[model samples]
Target: MDLSSKSGGGRTGYNPVLIILGTVVVLVGGYLISLLSPSLFPLAASAEAGPIDQLFRVMLFLGGVVFVLVEGLIILSIVRFRARKGEAGDGANFNGNVTLEVIWTAIPAVVVVFITLYSYQVWVDIQAPKDDELVIETEGLRFVWSFSYTDPLNRLAEADTQNFTDSVLHTYVGRPVRLKMETRDVNHAFWVPTMRIKQDLLAGRQTEVAFTPTEAGRYRIVCTELCGGGHGAMYSYIQVYATEQEWMERFIDVRVERILNPPTDPLTVGFNLLNENAYPCSGCHVLESVNWAGVTGPTLNGIGDTAARRASANGLGGAEEYIAQAIRHPNAYIVPGYNSGVMPQFGAEQDEPDAVDGAYYVYMSDDSLTAIVTYLCLQTATGESACGDEAAIRAAVEAQ
Candidate 1:
């Protein structure tokens, strides 16, 4: 057969059947690829997640179409237009078709414009303020997250402090939440994968992020930044209640009641303080009593007994002195296996500035430190305090 005739008069003409077949293949392949998107991501737990996930699917579909089209053309050309066994001389050459070039160029430009507009609209919609939003203050430290909230109704006017902090973020379905976030020590990121919202917590500055929960469930809150040694453990949760009534009954009312009638016992107060994450201790210590499972610092399971032994071995005044010095001046006596400068200095003197000459510090009131020491002093096998009475503990801390 003549090569010219075989090449359709030296110009390959478009075949309607091949065009239709290719279109079908691209459409089917793209749809199939889009369907896998749901499995590729976490559950859409917030209203914003829906739109973001949809946008992802759209982009995936377009990408699949382009991938299939390009790969298909390459394969077809290799197999169908390969040099024949008896062929000789160079194959026919011709200039590209202007119409085909324009179509290809125009298609991508239109796709780019469409994607830009669509993504912008999605972002604006998700960011729009919603009515009756529950504002929560968020703080990120080296290895912990603390969320604070105030009573919206002012029901606990008699309480000395109305604001409370927790290790978890709580909200209800259909209720918007806005977080004013800050970092106490280093730069960190607040990310909720299920909600598809992430914001950075920069040092010396505050940032904000907003989202509305659509599902009533628990979702993990992770710090996506590499903050420090305990960065992997710097995670919490957002608990979405089914309704406002449920949230009030389960979380809000309980916290308010506790605040209004604060516990009198120092042991109980200290336990609550640590349990509620008021001091960020749980992220660095392990104490089965309070369910702290951190692995960064020394274990507190039998801290009472250990304190007694450590004080005697280190020639401290008593177990109380050992515990007090451990907190106020963590570098005073470092544990044998643990390195110094790991724990923040919990300075008790209020007159001291939080930071001086670029040296960072964290403050703890004498009352709180006393209570915490009182609690830790009782974590013995016998359930008895290894340290002295409240007066002795206060004196031990004051001596430092």
Candidate 2:
């Protein structure tokens, strides 16, 4: 019953060195497996990044094969050269095998060369962008992304952001679309899971990310980086249309007209005209108490209260100066760096229609402008300050 006896196979055959080597190899192999997450995958950094995937995979496979070969040798040597009980004092010392040495060296060298060549080819394919392609301009700010589709007449595939998704940005299949990306504030990344393009946007410098969306449907565009307080809501959509014309007729042209002349009736525009064609604004900004993280526009809740964006006193005259300037030229005096285009010019101040009291901001004639300004000044006014904010009119009107 004594296992230490030679007949019972005492711990006589195992070589501690081989066991150590085998354990090391297995541990290395396991570490290799853990490096397979999306984060760990060799990202196609440039346009050439995609094709190198196969070569990258091959490199991984060769690494695994090498691990197996080395570990297998250690296991075999442990068992084959084990010490025998009463048969021999020790195993014979051995030198390296020239054949084994040459095989290990040569096989890997050949594999590495092939992988390099293959990867290079893939690199070439992706680095070169197509000649004629559309460009989407993206500007990233603290916690939001603004998409500018300059193509004007066309809209990208259209889809429902929350529940239903159907028509989306109509980008062509074969054509590569270059994204000119930058940031107004901190760093952000433009990511589209379907197209597999993720590019960083840095302030003061522009970055270019390109991809040919092979898909033909609506896809999501999300900010992959934690941008700001509301980073979780920083996302958008892209509609991938089969053809160019369909995108224009359906989404682009119609929206442009709307922005130029918003509908008069008490109807909320489909998507906020602010980002109707590009990023949806339902996440931020409030619309009739609906929460959308779109601080891109002034809140409608008390818009009438601040009659004049720039007012020394909340009198009637001061409020009038603010309202008129805000309507005619938004960029003249933006609210700090928050947003310049929050209020845009539909036409010249002369061209704006007269003001009217309704849900939408309507400008009738001179009479209405006076009426709206008066109405707004009264909305959140103290009984003492009315008749016109004389100080506001003096400074603003005189400056003009």
Q: Residue by residue across 1-400, what tens digits does model 2's lDDT show? A: 1112233444334456766776676656745643563346532322333544445555665666576767776777677666767776765567888986998799778877887788667645654578887776666654455555543433322422111111123455556877787775568888876665667888679988777766566667778887654566566667666666766666556655554555642113422333342223444444443333445555534544554444554342455576655544445555554554333242224333322211112222333333333433443434332326544433443333
lDDT, residue 239, candidate 2: 62
TM-score of each: 0.82, 0.47
CA lDDT of every candidate: 0.83, 0.52
Which one wins on lDDT? Answer: 1
After superposition of all CA atoms, the RMSD between model 1 and the true structure is: 4.1
Report the poorest 10 consecutive residues by lDDT, candidate 2: 354-363
| Model 2 stretches astray by more than 4 angstroms | 1-56, 63-124, 152-170, 270-280, 283-400
Model 1 ranges off by over 4 Å: 1-5, 70-105, 203-206, 330-345, 349-363
